[model samples]
Target: MYSDDELRPVSALQHFMFCPRRAALIYLEGLWSENRFTAEGRLLHRRVHDARRGEKRPGVRVARGLEIRSYRHGLVGKADVVEFHSSSPGQSPQVTIVEYKRGRPKPALDEPFHVQLCAQALCLEEMLGRGVSDGAIFFGRANRRVEVPLDTALREKTLAAIAALHELIGAGRTPAARYQARCRRCSLLHLCLPKALRPRATAARYLALATQPPAPDDA
Candidate 1:
């Protein structure tokens, strides 16, 4: 188990899952930049994190910008929202997390979303000593929340991501930039320079270079 000081931000898991090198660029190197997508996302979270904003309704209570941590997983961060729902007067309230996103959900990148929410649920379970069975992601574009179950598979993925994140941080070295289609949307694209950092050689060039004889030895 990690101490309080050793805990990493839960949000970094999304970065690592999206791109290891990108995560390194941000956390390991302390690099950051603002793009349209990032700006929008920041604003969305800002609205959700309003300190004075909260809600109480019949059999339910809502907290915004609730700080959460999991020493077991070495993760810590502020949740967008957490709802406590009680079915009966004498029953314990069910804990559920709700995360907000600026963009609509994409099928291709769904696992990372699940992993992030699961991490939050894991933190709540440890902090509250109550089971957090599920959560939801509020998509700004769609204007809806897509509920997610904290199933075994998702928990496994979340744990895996947490482990990999710790491993990356422990290594203390930024990974090489890798150009990909998704890099276009990343806020760190300019700083990351994945395209420029990529090797300027093709498979044929590598084959030709490999077949070349060694130059004459200079004593």
Candidate 2:
């Protein structure tokens, strides 16, 4: 278990991992400016989170907006949906966390979503005293659910990411922009102008005349 002073929210780890500046701005400075993407996600979550009044069907119960907290990791979260599995009405409950995302499944990275879901699992496991072996990510764009296993590998990665996040926050450093194509759509593009800062923009004319191959050596 971790002390409250030593723990950071799981969502912060994802933001810090993706872009430190953005994380710092949001967490430390309390700055937020939502665009179309963020607005859409909020609307989607509102629908599910608002429907959390517990509905029962056979041996399963669907719960929404389940409050969750992990003291060991220093995170507070809410599951958009939780499916409680029971063999009988009197049996102990097993929890399965489901998170809602506004985009389709990611291409090469699951770290961000996994960390968030893992944190919820940790909270549920602590509160319920049962192992959480798996969870799901529901993508809004694709209307699909992705099952993620809580294997040793994912657990280790999630913990490691938490540790790294603490170190980064402690150091108070923001990484320089790498200026990839992804920057174009970033909400912070106006704040992070890689194109304007590029050396090519300042030296384009000088290089053009110098690289004319020296007029065939003027023999």
Candidate 3:
């Protein structure tokens, strides 16, 4: 179990999964830059979280901007929305965490989002002492929600990601950048400078040259 001081933001898991160097730059080096995508995402979240305090309707209760944390995963963040549905009186409610996104879902790049939802479910489970088997992601662009199952695979991946995030933060050293297709979309592209730093030669050869001690000058 991690202490409160040791916990990192749950959102960092998505960043880390999308790009390790991007995570390090933002979480470790405290760097951030706003782009169109990020701005839209931020606005969407703000709108979701701005909903009035929790409300109950018939069989369901809706909460907005609910703060959550998990000692097991060493993560903390606020949920955009969480809905609880109670089937009958005097029974535990089923929890459904809803995350809002700005763009349409992209299956190829949805792993990070899945990991994020799973992490949030884990936090809810720990806090409520109940199983949270499902969640949803509401895409603003599509105006639809995609249901996600909190299965063993997703849980395992979420745990592994948390561990990796802790390790990366503890290392206290930024990783060297490697250019990739996704770098174009990264808001930290200017700060990361992957293209400028990426090796023209083989990666191993570049590392050797970079780490090798300079030759002593002869008189």
Clashing pairs in model 1? none
The Cα local distance difference test for each model comes to 0.85, 0.73, 0.87
lDDT of 1: 0.85
- Give, for candidate 3, the lowest lDDT window spanning 10 residues: 210-219
Best by lDDT: 3
Global Cα lDDT for candidate 3 = 0.87
Clashing pairs in 3: none
Clashes of 3: 0
Write the number of the candidate with greater lDDT, choosing between 1 and 2.
1
lDDT of 2 by residue, 1-219 (tens): 767666566667667656676676666656565667777888998999987479887877998988877776666667888898886567777768899989999857656888778877887888777898879999999999999888888888877877777776667765554567765555655444445545655566445543443222121
Distance from true position, residue 30, model 3, in Å?
0.8
* Residue 75 CA displacement from its true place in model 2, Å: 0.8
Model 3 residue 100 lDDT score = 88
TM, every model: 0.88, 0.79, 0.89
lDDT of 2 at 10: 60
Residue 48 accuracy (lDDT) in model 1: 87
lDDT of 3 by residue, 61-151 (tens): 9999999999988999988899999867788888899988899989888899999989998998999999999799999999989998889
Question: What's the candidate order when arranged by decreasing lDDT?
Answer: 3, 1, 2
